[model samples]
Target: MTANPLADDITQAAACLGGDGLLAGEVQGFAARPQQQEMAAAVEQALTDASTLIVEAGTGTGKTYAYLVPALLSGKKIIISTGTRHLQDQLFHRDLPTVRSALGVPLKAALLKGRANYLCHQRLHMTRSEGRLGDRRQANQLEQVFDWSGRTASGDIAELSNIPEDAFIWPRVTSTTENCLGSECDWFSDCHVMKARREAQDADLVVINHHLLCADMALKEEGFGELLPGAEAFIIDEAHQLPETASRFFGMALSSRQLLELAQDAINEYVGETGELDGLPDVARELEKATREFRLEMGQGEQRAPWSRLDGNPALTEAREALKTALADLAIQLEPLSERSRGLDNCYQRALRVQTLLAQTTEQPPADYIHWFETWRQSFRINLTPLDVSENFNSQRHALPDCWVFTSATLSVNDSFSHFAHKLGLEDATTLQLDSPFDYANNALFYVPKGMPEPSSPDYTRHMLDETEAIIEAARGRTFVLFTSYRAMNLARERLRDSCQFPLLVQGDAPRNELLERFRELGNAVLLGTSSFWEGVDVRGEALSCVIIDKLPFASPGDPVWQARIDAMKEGGGNPFMDEQLPHAVITLKQGVGRLIRDMNDRGVLVICDPRLLGKRYGRVFLNSLPDMGRTRDLDDVVKFFHASDALSL
Candidate 1:
């Protein structure tokens, strides 16, 4: 194939860095894969052509540099949106610096995270003075934070991983839009969030997470200015997650914990002790009691009842009213303290949201969305999300005439982009599918066990677990058994725990990256996980030689949102299973299968325990979606394939 002009430019750019001159300058001289070159071309073209572009560059593609290079070279203000905060930091701190240094480009780049990551000095001082440190544990955490703050130049909370993300101390230490005193605060001039924004405003490249990007798209903050002002282009990596993230930004949600936090914060302002709310623990106890009574009175016999049933309960009505009155009383008591403590502003705002949520839930909701209540051990949550995110995303895209680029490794089915394109409302957008340079034929085997029950069968989970155990034995424990449901994952974990000869690690055992680190360190550990593990996991060489998918990841029809979407599609003369569900499953399955081959010599076995793939008519669609692995039913062949390859080397 003739090299495109942008590709030629990238080639010359790589040549400037010396070495093999094939864009091989990786982070610390790690060789750049050929797929990275292809991705770089697509990104460069998207910039030059000024049109929407979608490309799927698989694992081991080194796609970070691919897009980063063109973005820096174009010298245009660009917003590079990532799926996670981890990647956002990596791109800004590590990848961007290396690429800019190697390519001899002196482009300024800034990393901006969501509002919650930055410390709110206004809230911090208020919390400290109000005696809101609560307990010795919190006080110690605060002391450590205070010491860290003095030394911290960036004021990014992520710098302190010792503190859990969900720590109660964070809400007290961090600033929110509602609670931020702005110029009134002593630290406003030195605010980390504002500093990051200022840097983003001046830089040619800005890195942000999807949530922040979507928030900017949906909320349109004025004082802080647009996130991508002066930006001519946008690149969203891990693009599959955009639809869900956009939906969350567009929708509304309220949880009991949020309400309680508000009540506690307000109470702290009034009582001058954070633990003073603890003295009123009876209030929480009463709330839980009333919630349970309300649920029982509502005829929600089972733990999981349709949200529609929430309105029928008179007890719920009474409970909600009682909660509202309590919150309002708390808010009234804190009104005077808001002047003294900026933290009280957040409490007041939260109370207002709770009151509003109660009102909205009582009223008839919009037909486009589904309202639901999720009951947990100690709390209840009310959620309202659009049944389909496509419409909202479509509206947003139409509103902006700016060029867009969405890329992921698994955006297509059998080389067709119709599913993802339709879902994202990009029907007319240009699309490309860059095949991974890894040779799957030599590197992997697709193992579909014979005579397994259909995925829908009652015994399917048990059978799948049994078969998975056998394969794990053969592979000698370098495995990732991915399940579609938590139920199956639990069952598999229970049944295989003692039987398996290797050390077993499940998803919940630790955070994903930590688990991966352990798994790689052990070298032959078996890790079992669900949806998150299906994609965005990079275990390139050893430590992962077998990937067993429980079944095709079809959205459960019984799921409230999925059911609503299916009905909506049916009304529009669309086959939800084919147009919506199948392609989604294809992309998901592609992600699971793509985990196997991360390098040219990397080898593994992809075993789909679900017989439906071979038995059902739609199976070919999923099969075709995968790379050309030598399909087989024999267990022995998979063992032979693994033994023959160098992937098993210690």
Candidate 2:
């Protein structure tokens, strides 16, 4: 006779992980893994004790199901948050359902995205009432969304697969916190966002992303139904991204794009509300003009300068004052008009929010902050980012008396969770590390080329191109040449443009998803990318066999944020390089390397061309952090691994 799976017995949790209990004949191709069972047991224990748990479940530990099975069967309200919406969707729509069916647990699960994702019925009505938002392409895109809004059960913009989310028209028809009418919205009765939140409020489980989690923590910004106070367990997937993302939310930011959008939203609201522009449209236009001129005055390209820089420079100070005055003037004009339209009232609130944000950005950086301004992609942004968000994170952690579980494939480096734990204020949490189940000795090779110069050398790109091309030849074009910067990625892409025979897919040539699809379809292709490609990407099989990292993934010293963190770490009797930077880089590198051997049958070569990884003493940390793949310097060994992988694929 089997014991109750819901009991606090860890053995029962272990049994459910097997094929005989809840998983009996329900999980196809089930292979019982001890490491998975161990992690599951740990999660179950944490839930029972209502304690915090930090789990570094390496690739192939089946960590998702390990935690989910216990959480669902516990019959407690659990909130699972991931670093990205893509992973959130996977857990809620795919993995959770699979586990729930097998366990036969009577659990209610809900998927809640940030408000920007859900269609604002109020905004949609306004968009229709005010026609032709942009060019013909944008018009067509809006028409498609208009059609999708009618049929989408979830009202998630992700449902409209044909139109890209970054389309210029999407913002005109979406609501931001600044612009949302909240309960005052005429369409509040049928609000998709509120409805989704209501589901989460009533659910046994809710899956959300890090941004929303952080937002909810800092300000109850989402108001997406209270989380920590209600859920019995908090499980954070891809926990490595939590600290940095939390830092962003805890900081202050004001973008020209956001102000411009506010201005535009105001214009749309005026037209939609009174069915006439009537002097209000001119106020928004003037503010936009001042904003554009201000952006130009901030200068060309990405520039990060201190508040002192802005104070001393006449052009910057003038631009700053002009923009500030314009925003205030815009608010003044909106006061009377706000009474005319509730939409205008929303826009009025948006202007005031921007004013507050701009003021926050211009102020002196608080004790643990780094402030700067930068222009990227033709938009100027000002930021005052926190040097540490641990305190803020801990506050959220204590908001409810519940178990907290942090799990990721690459959270710990050198079998130590101090770096990840301290970063997220989880120093006292229980930590566990599980290695990949795959036999990396036979399936993968960790190769480092002999006698390579430092990455700082001018000849780095040329040498990297030479060595990467050779590796691609050995792998027969199933390669991902990961770079540390855009300069290197573009340099290698240009050099390999004509030399390679296989389809050469560059990162910016198309959308990341499209690039991966093309790489898979081509079966043998070389894709070159920078930071964005390093993580959250999964390509199983021989289509991706060789991963060639150009350099040790280091945070650039030039970044104002990195500089502030280094200073902060130094102030606390710590070696910033050893304590903060190195561990972070090792985790990132592990993520890149883990891409090679995804499944049990998968086989590949991971060639890191950075020689500093061999010369530097701290490089031992990275070496120790990666999977225990068979090490080799011989190019022929890479050739052999690729041949074996290719044969297996065939």
Candidate 3:
């Protein structure tokens, strides 16, 4: 009989995660979960077979260790991509070490982030010599970065905790693909991005985020040098976010910031190389002026509108034309001086690329693409996003011919993987859905208040706040009130300011991490937030005892991307609501609901304020997608749940 080495490998992985095995015995307070062990076995099978696998391990399934143990034990080259950089760091620094230690596996691991996260030594020196800062504060921050740059090894900006990530000085120091001088750079040998990529290539396991993964995929599609190393297996931890992240990367964008940066770089390079701003500064300034004027003509307030809205507006159209002409003039000027210096040459190439993208963006979009523009306070971005990213993503997946595992707590809508699989075009993938090991039936309560008005009514916010006040009083301020729109969140903040007794933390008041820290510390704070607060937020135990949602999280019809997809679906004789919109909302709502019951010992109440969950026919889909918990329409039951918790504490 032939010895099955792959089967033996999977058996060893399961044993390590089993009840009386390595993790259970060696790791402190580690309770072995059957679901987690099952997931590990499945992951091992996929790794050994080199096949595609989609698994939805519900909350508390220990999915991190589930996949990590197998990948570490498999001894194959692996790349694990997370949803955000924070998660990437957490897995690399926290979870991976724990699992490897328990399994006693000796493996090389590395963490690689996007280029923007790393400081560019070339750009930093240029910024210092240029001495162009907005204010004294920015100047001081630049010096702080300079001081730390010398002591740092990895060049990751997160190390300089004193400077906020959103500081204006960072952009002046970091390099983007458009501005980075690859081989011609004087600091190419000491480049942090290059060093990280090299380490990733050498390591047996690599940790990265979704944006970097998608960026590498995009670069590969364009026939550029790949940002990541070829791997035998790829594990996407937060698989739910990949489709959207891929959309952004697979698409093309022209932003006001890119144009403004080009203008500034041109002037800086010309002055540095020629020692005088003879004729280039004026042309560069024209480009800057035109970019700002075009932004102003777009609108007064921040908005996202389709490019078609510019059809009848002559002033906006003229501004856009003037902007394009300014870009053309600058490109013509830089063409003559392209050989002056590498900096000038790079700027010339960037100018031409931006010009091409601007023309393509403003022109009629190609098939399967949606042309739209979004504006902020002082900047705007014209984007061309594909209506469906599945085709591109599927092609990339098939091109690799490697093991791919997509796992998330919310991938399945109504206990089916069809929605998520269809989005990513996973044609032939094995699927697994493991319910959480948490005791949700006894510890959680799902509530939808009675006597609520339609979400479209003007009084809906008022009514929603009224119901939330009752739940807040019951839960004693341990609640999260998530809204679908910023308008609703702001209104709730204003109304609850005078009425609610608990400490209220609004989203925009501070950084998200700070807000979450305060919420966890206060133990009785009610956080009011919008879309960002719904997912990627984990607050276990009693700090977060309730989650209050304002409405069904349907993608806004006003959003250009969503509208385009809806139109395309309708044209194809598909039910846009059921086929496209509803699944998206169900997935989003599940994210919101996930914040409630994170662990087995956690007890909480979930209040979804939208009456549509019970009033409409499509409500059953949303209801069926959530965890099996006790349901109620009365406020007394919610209050009793909390009171019982108080009794236990006493």
Candidate 4:
């Protein structure tokens, strides 16, 4: 047998991460961790052999540096994907530089986000000339963006922090795949999206979020050109989120917002370029009215339901027909005007795409897809999600590169990676699990409160809040009360508002980052939040001392997409609860419990108020999946633990 030549790099990579090595001499207070070094060796081996590797490095494992050192040493053109845009920024602007500088490697890097993140010069100009603002405030916001456009070089909206990311004005000033005129755009020379992609193509390393990666995968599936440059290796930082994100992009979606935007754009183009002929403006206005009427028929409040729910309702049926007719009328009117200008041509193509998706949605869905609709306050989305994305995701992975590394903190359940592997059809990949180097055994306490009602009971939130109040008081209000549902979080907020004394911060009262900043600054505030707060949150030192979970984080049976998958699993001769639901819940619970004990010196109590943790048979799966902390059922033990910490602090 021939010896592998690149195997020497594994040892070199591990040595560089070791004590008395390059990093130890460069970074201050950088303690050498055995787990991080082991992970770096495994990543190096994967890169050398051009194979697949999965690693679940627990919290505080320094996974970022572990994968990065090997990637830089290999000198391969690499693409690193993160779970969120904020993480992308952190890795590109902060972590990447630290590692590259420590290794003294001169690798060029780039940060690429989706097109929507960059401001579109053409759209900004059209929005300014159209003068169709909703109010005076929107007009002022447009002027602010316009003024900043000249001074900015990158055109990334994140650079302008005066306007919120979710402000209504952003949609008017940005572009999407549907509305963006590729090379025909007037501002093609100065396009921010193109500029970012060009940099990514030229750099040796590119950092992007999951959305852009999946978008490239879906585009390739459609035989379109790739959005990303070819790379020798792809390292997914938060691999646990890949399957879900891939499923979304692999499927199809048509939104009411897209339809309304097409209508408005068509009217604007007609006024600017085309003559007032054939009642084109009137037809576009009809589409606007039909879209709003259809939204009204979806009923009040946010909701998600299977498309079959519209089978028997006559009003919904009529509204859908009106929407379809309005779209067809607009398409017919714009087909002739497409040659008038590039903007009209883009609108015509968008209208046809929406028409096709609408027709497919109203028909009998394919056997392998779940047809569902979701609605919010002002918009709705009709989605066709695949029942199993294993085949599709596997194909995309194979097409990408010879080497792949999928690493995350919560990718395994009960110390096994089978569930995650099966989701993405990565059964052949090598797997490794590295426990956190933090002192969880000595610093953290896992408390499952006694006398808790069933999670489904009407009085569950009331009782859970009643118990959490005492713990918050004992911990001096440095607590995060994480819930599985908005209903529960809101109820806890309402009850605590009257009884608790500390500063209360709720999720909807402000933005997520804003709420987190307040929680840290107050030093003694109780923060209530839902699923978004479970993971991707960091609080160290004495600021955060307790975490209270209302229940096991399980997929709700009421969700249409989840229910469809559960039913499909049953039909395929699988135990829906055991094979699917239980494993998913175990992984999610691990992420929630991971909020505490971020550092070696951090000490806190983890409170699971769900009685099922002790009452059900599968509860052991969840408990075993979490870190090996001291477990207790007594409330007095928690109070005493906090009291001991307070004395030590003094």
Candidate 5:
């Protein structure tokens, strides 16, 4: 095989794999899709050329290999960053190994997760001695972990999935930088995180999540030494999420649930009953009740009413004061409990967090910070976040000067990268977009249901649900009804549950992966979900033939983080909607639409039940962001499109 000279010279040092490399495919049997080959060439050029690269390789472009081959062959110590832990694992375990074997080289690679994944020996010892395992299930899991610790080489909690990820027991086992005893710990000499870092430092390629990458960019002394390690480049997969994740890391947030958890944990440690807080449960219950009452009083009868400030209602004022006093009393009780139980450290820490949150909520925040209260289900929450992430992003970029490459299936809007570029402070960076190999017009129909009201109208939700039901019926059970809000998702799920012939799957019914597994397994299933499902879902083939998006995903104006950002933009004389919200929605809509076509042969219908896409001028921006599917309004046409593709496939 003739290697492209534009490819890295390290390709000459290739070593063939001796085994199957743990995947079903052959090690040397990899074939690059045309777009992937082009992207790989471009990335190779970017390294040689020392240019910042931004490429959008839509789904099935095989982007991971396109960048990985160049990165591995570059002989450059490179960091491959992803948006989620799942992707991080996929690259490290599946993709990297396959690529390395195909290249026929002894290239070294390391998968570094966040600090939270590594076991904290000190915490583990403390919690074990204190018998703070909480539940019987956790105790059993801990017993297995203890046994596994002796024989396991890498102390990654991910290695043990039998234990639920949300099991609080992991916190007892894992160590954060805050809680790590560092050099003083008994496990310091054998620290798994340190070992991983050392391996990463010596390896040709390092795989990491964006959170860890951003932590290295933001925090001074994070365990993972400098992010790039004087590497030739950094390739960020799932790059569309970079801006939002960056915003989160660059900003600050303190939630009440965190505080309440802390208080309850402290009580658990003191009472030696690790189930729930002893005397404090009643107090916590009353606090929740009071908070709900306050919200009700403030909202009157309007469920969707927004709160501008915290000073209007006398009842709200009284509730706030009472809640604060109760929490303070709870905090004092927790202090003693925390002192008695080192296992209660997280609990005590959370209590202090709650106290700080309460204090912050009552005070006047800086102009840079946006503060707001959210009422959900039976609880209320106060939030504070930064107004603009551009400044912070710019600072980070200037601080770290390695060649940064951001790639995703949906980063650009209508061939323009302006929205994403601005958000990521990519003013001086190189940008490229690689269209998916999938034939969208041939395989997919863009169904903009006609005569629907604007999304802003009160009747929009019901109308959108009705339209979605029609499309689902036409597609005959292979559908994804994606909504922007939980209320809408629930309503649609409830309305269609009895009427729909197929098995209905909702988001919260299980973990995302499990839900997806079931969706694919069921074959004819109607899955209704919200934001998280919009992106990262890969349901190719006949399982997912229809996708219904309720509306263009605009950031809620009442969202505390968004309101702060809008206010900040206003102060700077910029249109917040244009600069921030529209682009965000466009990127998100791209993700939702991209879900439809997974392979060149896969056929589906993307039904936008919201009329705003046609009614409003900004809607074109979203329409243009999607793959060029033939548009249709007639229900018969959509059904015809699906059946036509199915026939062609047969």
Candidate 6:
């Protein structure tokens, strides 16, 4: 009788993980962790049993491999989705190869990004034929991409190392669903997007981010969007972000950029398909002019309004009517060539979508949705955002595979998965909670200054800066002063610049990756950042010793969608503040605190200046949710701890 080979392989893989592992004999600095092994076993079981598992493995738990090992060993095809592209690129390019080598499994894997990430050869050719862009910089950048386009095999814009991600030229060279001519394009034979999709469809494991997964699920009717139809299992790492990201996918939005882009494409396609009819350019100009007038009336820089405010404006009404009239005329002109060219068909389809969205914005939304308008400098967008995505999200069982696993360190609030489970509509899933293996008692201190002003107080920022001085000095500037708002961050940047000798790195000084790299090299720099810095950021050692949070991470009440949801909850006799807001803030705060104490040997100070955590009744939620560490009120204890660490280092 032959024993099961997978059983031995699993055991061998487990053994090879830490000090006793086979790799340890060949490599240096490997220590076996019981948490990793335990998690791997649980993951294996979850995959085998076809059960939904929500596991919270804390920092230093070796979570990536914990799930990846079981996923690789299952032999069943799985789609592992992460919250960020950096993690997606890491797993597909780095981590998966190492795991496959360790386990000796040759399972196939591929990385799939959205269509916009790939360069469209047809679009590049079209841009070149259209002549130089007005600006010298724009024309030069276009020429640079033209040269690089010939050399890039993958056609990934990310490979353009010299260019910034926000480069204006990327939009002109990349393909969007609205402008892509599909099989009718001349470059169809060598399309990068189609080739990537072929790899994804053929591989046993497909690595994707949350946005792509949501798109695949949302756009199932499109043939290429059927990326998940054949997979046997699903694993969503960083499951806490899934619910929020899912909302954006489930919602409907029509931006003025979409309108203008469609208008521009209509003009170009009309010329390509039929050599420029007399009225074609005029039709496109009318649409663009309407958008400009609409935006002019909307006012700008950043503002959100309920549908009533936008709909009530006479200029906006006149602009929408003018846009509708222009689109109707454009459709009439393009009707003759729509059958001859897929490009014209695509433009007509976009026109239809724009018309439908324009008409729908004036109508009352369904009871479960909130209709709102937002404005930026160049565009005004109307959105039919879902107030409650649970029902819509839960109805996606048809889109998912049988085996499901959702894992993250911050999924649970107050040591239970109720909040995450309820938010994501995953009620009956099996739950597991694993605390961090770090000795936080000895390695970390939680400092809340005594007699701090409340967050709502006008003097809060000034007072918080006063409290921050001691801790910043104690850690000797290895600090991340995280803020809930740009207002707080800017204020801190202003006050702290004069108050301290330590160099300060503000969020917008450079890109996030550049800033993080600079922070590590600077050694004693105090980095002030908000939202994006809180999660998916890892800095090991004393480089990031302290994390100071300005306030609880509550969603702004002024947010149209948030306010609508809050109103709905109130009407239904639920406390939106307690049920929805608190749990969310707890999870977010956990992510911010997580930046400190990243690895087993790392040490840091966590100073939260928000008085709500001490003065309010709901503060207990935060206190209970955070990792248990040594607590302090006096500044001397922090200084002494730093002194002791410095002495030990000497």
lDDT of each: 0.75, 0.84, 0.89, 0.88, 0.73, 0.83
Candidate 1 regions with alpha-carbon error over 4 angstroms: 1-22, 25-34, 129-139, 220-224, 271-306, 328-350, 398-401, 646-650
Candidate 3 or 6, higher lDDT? 3
Residue-level error in angstroms, candidate 3, position 583: 0.7
TM-score of each: 0.90, 0.96, 0.97, 0.97, 0.82, 0.95
lDDT of 5 by residue, 531-603 (tens): 9999888998899998888888897887656776787788889998877888888888888888888876788
Tell me the tens digit of each residue's lDDT in model 6 across 1-650. Answer: 11112233445336556566644554346567777766777778778888788888888887888888778878999999999877888888887887787777889998888888888998988888878477888888898899998898888787776787888888889988778888888899899989888898899999888888776667732224666768889899988999888787787887888888888888888887668656787888888998788788787688887887777678777777887898787777667768878888888887887788777765667567789988887778888888876777777854567688888989888877888888777788878787888878899999998898878899998888888877888789999999999998999888888988898999998999999999999999999999999999999988898999988899899888888889998999999998888999999999999999987888888898887898899999899988899999888988988888777666
Leading candidate by lDDT: 3
Which window of ten consecutive residues has the lowest lDDT sum in model 5? Answer: 10-19
Worst 10 residues of 6 by lDDT: 1-10
Cα lDDT of model 1 by residue, 372-477, tens digit: 6667555566777777777778777666646788888888787787777877788878776777777777778889988788777899898888788888888889
Predicted structure 2, TM vs. truth: 0.96
Better of 3 and 6 by TM-score: 3
Badly placed stretches (over 4 Å) of model 3 are 1-10, 220-229
Clashing pairs counted in every model:
0, 0, 0, 0, 6, 1
Candidate 5: which stretches are off by over 4 Å? 1-32, 220-222, 227-229, 255-308, 311-364, 372-384
Task: Kindly provide the TM-score of model 1 when superposed on the true structure, using C-alpha atoms.
Answer: 0.90
- Candidate 6, 589: how far from true, in Å? 0.1
lDDT of 6 at 22: 48
- Specify the poorest-scoring 10-residue window by lDDT in model 2: 1-10
